[model samples]
Structures are given as structure tokens and as C-alpha cells.
Target: MSATPPPTSSPELKRVVTGALVGTALEWYDFFIYGTAAALVFNRLFFTDSDPAAGTIAAFATFGVGFVVRPFGGVLFGHLGDKIGRRSTLIITTLIMGVSTGLIGLLPTHPAIGVWAPILLTLLRVCQGLGAGAEFGGAATLLAEHAPPGRRGYYASFAQTGVQIGLVLGTSAFLLVQLLPEEDFLAWGWRLPFLVSFALIGVALYVRLRVAESPVFREMERTREIVRLPIKDALARHPRNFLVGVGAHINDTAIVYTLSTFSVAYATAELGMSNHGALFGVILFALTVIVLQPVYGNLSDRVGRRPLNLFSVVFVALFVYPYFLMVDTGVPWLVWLAMMIMGAFGFAPQVAVQPVFYAELFGARVRYTGFAASRELGAALAGFSPLIGAALAARLDGAPWLVAAFLIGTAVISFVAFYASRETKDIDIADIADIDIAGIDPVRKPVAEE
Candidate 1:
């Protein structure tokens, strides 16, 4: 009998990449706008009349709520992705995120409904969290499964590009709102950005709906090789890889959140910048990150994942303290430069390469579940780091060093965990399913009778 040939890459790969990038951009735009709102306006609107410090803390705590619920969304969506298909899961997540974001724009403020305002806002944020938890995993899997051999990193990095674009749009929109009169901005202008999400979500749905299912997933379905319980199988068969994947993502999550979301609160509350100035710095940083992610991703293709990822971590450890020192000087341009460099060059490489690295860690059978669970689990730690940093900032009298030290510690943990992982740069996607152990051993153990 003749052997069956491996699936070949076609124009479909381009379609999948385009769909993933556009859909993810819209989803993240919705998610990121919420973060920007929480950092700036949500507190005053929802927590009205509280102490400023206490309100900021409460606002960020609600931001962290989304991160807390994300893991559950990952599990739920991951199961659906592995069992049914990536296309449908992507469509569902985008709708959920869009609807929740639109609702937040129309929600009643504390003045109108008192305590129910924040409570309803928290409920909507949870819905956003659930949608986001699954969105990245599905997009990454869709791109990775369709990419040609030896170029998965290049193609998968496109999803990260969507993330950068989303951040850019989200922050830029908020900056635009900052230009409004103070009273108008607080009363109604802030809600305009959230309302804008509906138009972007429509674009995402159109793009995603046209893309076909991943070839690898279709093959698995045709062969009746889909795992009956993907999450359980992933846990049992790939515990070490899952742990490594989670650890590898720690720095990316922690540092990105710290530099972007937490920095807004830190600057306005602690460093005495106006809300507009703080958000403007974040907008500048987001633009740099958007430009640099694809470059770093292509660099990873040449240098391999471990070396580039390690380089990023080491740079983050060395630069975070100095960056904070510059920010503490209270010079607007210096703070902007520091944030731009930290986000663009210091943080981009790790974030750019991680989707490929994490996707490569699992086989086709459970790629969605493994990637979703591991990445979301790591992100949950990051979601809370801002709250932890806020608490520490209160005790330290807004000393930036404390937050820097905490970020560096997390980076070190990521570096060590990544160092211990097996390299998958040259492994074929089809063959990944067979790599059940970390290394080869010649000795075989006898099966014991149960």
C-alpha cells in the first residue's frame, strides 16, 4: 500500500492568518478598552464619592476580576475548540466580548443607580474575561495549525500583532476622549469609546466567519482521533509541558500589565501626572510595541525561541528598575521614553514568540486545551499583580522600586522555567503528537498488574 502524503500549505493558510489577526484585534480592542476605562474613569463613575485612593484600588480590583474568571472561560472554550472546531469557538467568543463591551457603554452610573452600577459593571467585566480567555488560544491554534513547517513562529506571531493593534486602538481612542472638556468627558465622552466597539466587532465577525476550519483539526475529525475529554487528556499526558508553558508566559503577562494598565494608575495617583498625560504615555508605548512585535517575532525565527526569550527576560530584569527610576523623576518625556523602550524592545520579544512556543508544546489532539489552560493560568497571576503592586505602593509611599523588584522576580522565574524546557524549533507539527516524554531513555519498564 502507498503512504498517504502530509497536508500541504495553501492559500487557505493566508486566509486563516488574516481571519485570526482581524478577529483577535477586535476582541482585544474590546478587552483593552475596559482596562483603560477601569484605570481612568470607571472608579469615579461607579465608586462615586469614595476616597480617591480607595476608589482606584476598588476599580483595579474589578479589573482583576476579569482575569480571575478567564481561566474558566479558557477551559470552557478550549473544550469546545478541541471537540467541535476553532472557527465556531472564535465566532462565539468575539460575539460575547462585543456584546459585553457595548453593554458597559450603556450602563447606569452610581448617580443613577447607586451601588448597582459597580456590581453590574463587574458582572459585564466577567463576561469580557470569559471571552478573552478563549480568544487567544483559538486564534493561536488556528494560525499554528495552518502554518507551514519551520515557519510557525512567523505565522503565529500575526496573532500577537492583532494584540498590539488592539492596544493601539484602545489607548488611542481613550486619548482622543481625553481631549474633551473635563465635565463632558466625565459625564458622557468616556462612554463613546466603549460604544465604538460595536463597529469593530462587526468587522471581526465578518472576517472570522469566512475563514475555514484548520486543516489539522479537520484531519483529526475525519480520522475519529479527537480526544473524548481534551482537558483531562492534556492534564494527564502533558503535565510538565503545561507547567513549563504557564511559567514561560509569566513575564509577558506580568510586565505587560504593569507597564500598561498599572502604570496608568501609578502615574496619575502617585507621580502627580494628569490622567491625560498618563494615558498619553501608554499610547506612545503601545505604538512602539505594535511596531516592534513582528520584528522580534521574525528574529525569533532566526535565533530560536530559548535564546531570544531568555534575552528578553534578562533585559526586563535589568531595565525595569532603571525604567521606574526614570519615571520617578517626573519628567514626562523621560517617562515616555522609558515606557516605550520597556514595552517595545524589552517586552515585545517574549510576547511575540510565546504563542508559537506554547502551541508547539502540545499535539493537535489537545492543542487548544493545553494552550488555553496554560496561558490563561499564567495570565491570572498577572491579573492580580497590579492589585498586589497597588497594595505595596500604598505601604511604600509610592516607591516605584517595590513594583520593579516584584516584576524582576517574576521575570527570573520565567527565565528559569523556560531554560528547563525542551526546544521545539525544528519539530514538525505532525510529529509533536508523538513526543510524550521530555527525553529518550533506552531502558523500558515492565507494566505492573493492577
Candidate 2:
């Protein structure tokens, strides 16, 4: 392997990272607003015919529907991303997600339009899934491919940070709307969060359109390294890496859904907490991730991605039960503390490193497809975690132990995958596609000679 790095000037790096971050934030903002609504408003608004518990389950099922369509999104956009360019695919995805989310604001309720309300809501959610499927993988790929060597984790962390910022914005919007009179909040306030996505999409487009395509992708095309069928190439050549990516990502998705979406519904409907208290706790914890994620990502550059990933799953396994134990106490401080620890400390570190971590597993030819396909497949399973948790709790007479056990099981799956994977934090970007497993060293490599 040549001890030379890919071309990534500082000025280009800044512009690319900023574009990735802003675009990711907007896409996730649109996506998360649906999750928040499914928990707080959709059950009552769209699924009015069912009893309360059943209604919540149905609503969360719709939320999961978005995830179900993500792999297809990844397949569709990843192909375009590999064949055409990341910048263009991302532009189209932003429009799809933003327009779909905004249209959701205009959807009628069950009382007004009957079953069509939920059906239309589900269709919009699918559009969200389709766009999001390609959104993160492409953004992460763009940022990682443009980042300075030895700092991929630090730079790519910005994409995950954008995701947390989106959650914060979505939850905060709900919190603001919840302050209105209950009837009014239910009638129209729920639409505000979805409608605001139109403006966010505009800002994302402005920044994203100006940023250049990933330097690495341009290099790949120049060298004729772009494959005709990237997903097929990825699965055929790097099957182990693809499987590892799926296994390694599940805990992050499951845990986040449990805390941000499921916990809100569980707190409000089951635990008898006010919506404001539940949303406040989530918003507070999500805000901490914006700070903690980048720090952990930077740390991974020095310490290696494996140790932190292992620590994340282990932490989730040991703490999942206690996290809920704290939530059940009904003290706002205790709930917030648990959320902070679980989200900021446990989950943040895993995701902070994941974008680059997964991206590094494949060669440039199939990185986008490999990353998106594997990650979204994992997300599909974890997306229904809230509904699963609710069903488990409902079946067990409102006890959360069954749900906690399910989370621990997911952690174990991720832990084994992380344990088996080779660390790539220090691998040269040019060599990563073809680097053998035996060639990978967990310790940082010597810096390439200038």
C-alpha cells in the first residue's frame, strides 16, 4: 500500500462537513418529527378507533413502516450515489423527505376522514423511510471520504451529531406545542413541527448544493473503480463486513427508539406522566448528545473504534434494566439522569464512530451501498422496538423487564459483531477497500509520509 493520503484540503473539508451536517440535520428533523408524533399525537388523531394501548401500538407500527422501506431506499439511492454522485442523490432525498413530512401536516384525522387518515399517514411515513434510507449513508460517506486521514472519526461524527440535533429540534417543537390548551394542541399544534420542515429543507439545499462531490468518489470514478451494481458487488465481495455492519448497528437503533420514542409514550400513557415532562426529559438528554458524540468520535481516533464499540454494547447490556428502573421512579431528575447516561454516554459513542466505522469496512467501489444496506437493514428491525416494547409491557401487566431483556439481547448481538470485526481507524483511505482482515492492526498505524 502507498503511504500517501487522498487529496483533502482543509477548505474543502470544512465545506463538506458543514454541508453533510446541515443536510443530515434537516432530514433527521423531518424523520424524527414523525416518531415524536406517533408517540404523542398519532394514536389519538389517526388511530382513534382502537383502545388506547392498541392505538399506540398501531401508531408505532406506522413509525416502524418507515424503517421497513429504508433498505429499498438505500438500494435505490446507493446505486445512484455510486453511479452518478453523492451530491445529486442527497439533493433528491432531501426534497422527498421534506415534502412528504410537510404534506403530513395537512393530513386529516380519523374523525374527519376515517381510515384514509391512517393509510395516508402510513404512505407518507414510507416516503420518509425511503428518503432516510439513503440520506445518512450518503452523507456519512461524503464526509468520511472528504475528511483528513487519522481524523475520519472526528469529522464523520458531525453527521451523527446532526441526527441528535434533529431529535432535539423535533422534541423541542413538540414541547413548545404541548404548552397550548390540550384540545388546541391536539387539533392543530401537532402540525407545526411537520410544517416547519419546509423551511429546514430550503436551508439544507442551499448548503448542500454548494458543497462539491466527495473527493474520494471523484477519484474512484477517475480510476474506473465505480461498479455497475454496487450492492451486488458489496455482498459478493465483502459479505462478512456487510453482516457485521448490520449486527453492530442494532443496539444503537433499539436503544435510541426505546429512549426517545417508546419512553415518551410509555411515560405519558402508562406511567401517567405529563407530555411536557416526558418531552422535556428527552429534549434535555438529546441536547447532551450534540456535545458528547463529537468528543467520543475524536477519542476513537486515538483509542481505536473497537474498544469504544464494545464498551457501548456492554454498557447497554448492564444498564438497560436500571435505565428503565430509574424512569419508572417518576422523579423528573432521576429520569433525566438516566436518559443522559444512556443517550450521551452509552449511545452517543457508538454512533459517533459508526458512520466512519461502517464506511471503512468496504472499498470505495461499494462503500455507500454496503454501509446503507447493512445499516438500514438493522434499523428496520430496531425501528419497531417501541411497538415491541409496548407489546411486551402490555402483555406483562405493564412491567418493563421483558422489554429490558429484549434490549440486552440486542446488545449481545452487537457485542459479538464488534468483537469479531477488525479495527480500521488508522487504515489509509486508499488501501481500505482491498485491505485484508489479517492486514488490519487494532493499534494505530504510523502516519503516512508526506
Candidate 3:
């Protein structure tokens, strides 16, 4: 019942992939700097209550706020992505993210604004969550649809690569500002990273404005196959994929925040490590992930996505305890090594293969809604990971066993999800009938089309 996509030329595919990469990289850079600020600056600047531990948890709670509202963003933007087109939806998302980030750089702190400070920060974070909700999903979908059937994994991985680049840029911006005196860093330098978004917004706009629409979506439009309520249709028609995508996302979402945001706060608070050192570990970890994304992605293209997904969760489950042990050693080199090892095998492979894997779970009609909502829901559920890590560590008097156990539990969830889901690397994404969704009904069409 699906229309065939127009044949995509190689040059167009490359152009789209490049745009997705540059645009996502810039957007995610905004997301990551906020994480860094939560770890280092927000607690002191915005949530200036007593109790250092409580303040840290409060800061991370605001960080989690961005994740909690993501499903709403998913629904709103996913509708636009499925209804209008992927290209325009991505451009809107980038605009939302970039503008919100730039505003954060100019916000007044608690000392100047009192209670209004945290309130405004929370409000701005909601804006970020909304924009971010669909950024990755739309980028991945666009890349997957443009990609040749055999190379979807390899190409879609670029979306994730852009995310790592953003992490590098976000962390690197903080690192540069760290060269300032501590007083200067706390006063004005912290704002510099967020302010860079002003510049990045332009670059993102330039790239995204040039990207082509998904050919699969074009075919859907040409044949009037657009869905009216895509989220409802996705849930009713492809419940299994909806659930699999949700469960499959928990491990990476929780672990990445735990490793990047929580671990930074943990090291500075408990291990007596300098903020510079802990942030350096994240940079190293991100660099490792950036390097291995394409390697794992290309491998998934050859061997299939399931194996890498399974291996990643299992490795992460087993490695969490050892990971904590290495970090607790308080040795800078060992900490960097711990981050890299986990980032390499534990996080990168699954994440690299994830976009294409999720992309193939539904037909193009529901792909944006299903992927963004399900994945972001998992993220919402785990969004409090850094807060949880802080609370658990405080409860245990700085011991990390409880947090380790929590991560292992998340890993188990994803392992079961990967086991239940079918391999999708070889599937034709445009063929609604051939996708691996359960109880997929092909005759259902949108009540209205754009």
C-alpha cells in the first residue's frame, strides 16, 4: 500500500547527510554545554539553597527537566515532520534549540533575580527539551530514507557522530573558558559557552536550509499517504516497535548522562579531582565515541544491527562496577581510560547503529512520531539519571555501588529489548509491509494530507 520513493542520486544523499551532520552537531553542542553547566555552575548560580548535596541534586533535576518534556516535543515536532516534511521540521527544531541556548547565556543568576532565576532557567530548559525531542529522530530519519538499502546503518551513524562532535564542542568551549581565573570563570566565563550558540545558530540554519526533503516522505506526499494522528496510528499499528524502541533506548540514555554529567560532579565532589580533570575525561570519552561511530556503523551494515546492540548492553552491564572502581581510584589517566573504554564498547556501537535500527522499525508514515516519542520517553524515564546518581551517592556516603546497580538494571532492560526486536539492516525502509513491526496494518491512511 506504500508508494515507491523517487530514486535518490548519490550527490543528493551526500548533501543531505552532510547537512544532517552539521546541523545536529551544532544543535547538540547547545544541549551538552547545559549539562556541563549543571554539573559545575547551575547549582551555585541558580539553586543557591544550603546543603551542597541538595543543591547539586537540584541542578541535575533541572538538567533532567529538559529530558522529561522531550516526549511532548516529540509529538509536536514529529507531527510536523510526518505532516509537512523532515527538512522543514529539522530546521524549526534547530532554531528552537539554538535560540533557547543563546538566551541561557544572558540569564540573570539567583543573586540578582532571587527565586525568579531558577524559575526562568527551568522554563528555558523546557524550550531546549522541546526542540531536542525531535532533532535526532528527524536527522536519523532523513539520513535513513536518503541512504541506499544496504548502507543505511553506515550513513545514519553520521547523525550520532554529529552528536559527539557537539559534545566535543560543548566540553571544549568550557575547557577554553577554564583558562580564566576561577572567579572570572564563575562570573562571566561560564556564559561564554552558552553564548556561542548565537554563532552556531547561523551555521545550523545555513546548513539545514539547504538539506533536501526525504524521498520516502515525498512519495508518501505524492500518493497522499500521510497520517492524520501519526502517534495514535503508530501505537495502534506498531505497538511492538513502539515498545522495543522505548526499552532499547534506556541504557544509552541513562548511561550517557550518568557518565558525562553525573560523573563530572562526582569526581569533583568526592574524588577531589579538579573540574578540569573530570571534564577532560568526558572530552576523551566523546572523542573515542566520535571515532568509533562510523566503524561500528559500517560493521552493522555488514553483520546486522542486533549483534552490536546486544554486545553493547551486555558489556555495559558488566562494566559498570569496574567503571566506578576505576573512577574511584582518583587517578586522572585511569579515569580517562575508564571513560574511553565504556564510551568505545559500551556506548558507541549501540548508539551508532541505533538511528538506522529505529528508522527501520516503522514505515515512513509513522517513523518520525514512533521513533521520537518512544525514544524520548525512554530518555524521560532515565532523564533523572544524574539526579539519581547524586542522590544515591549521597545516601551511601559517597559509595557508588547503588548507582552501579542502577545502570546494570537499565542495561538488562535494553538487552531484553534487543533480544525481542528483529534485525532491520537489510529491510527496505520504504516497504511498509516488510518492516518488523508487530500487527502492522497497511491499509490505514491519513484522514487528511498536507
- Top candidate on TM-score is 3
Quantify all predictions' global Cα lDDT against the true fold: 0.83, 0.87, 0.90
The TM-scores of all predictions, comma-separated, are 0.94, 0.95, 0.96
Please give, for residues 1-450, the per-residue lDDT of candidate 3 as tens digits: 355576679888878989989999999999989999999999988988747788889999999999999999998999999999999999999989999999999999999999999999999999999999999999999999999878899999999999999999998899899999989999999999999898888999898888889999898888887889999888877788788889999999988899889999999899999989999999999999999999999999999999999999999999999999999999999999999999999999999999998888777888999889999998899889999989899889988899999999999999999998887676677864423343444323343321
TM-score of 1: 0.94
List where candidate 1 sits over 4 angstroms from the true fold.
Answer: 1-10, 434-450
Give Cα distance to truth, residue 393, candidate 2, Å.
0.4
**Model 3: clashing residue pairs?**
none
Comparing 2 and 3 on lDDT, the stronger one:
3
| Model 1 lDDT per residue over 108-161, tens place | 999999999999999999999999999999998888878887787888988988
Ranking by TM-score: 3, 2, 1
Candidate 2: global Cα-lDDT? 0.87
Per-residue lDDT for 333 in model 3? 98
The collision pairs in model 1 are none
Angstrom error at residue 186, model 1: 1.2
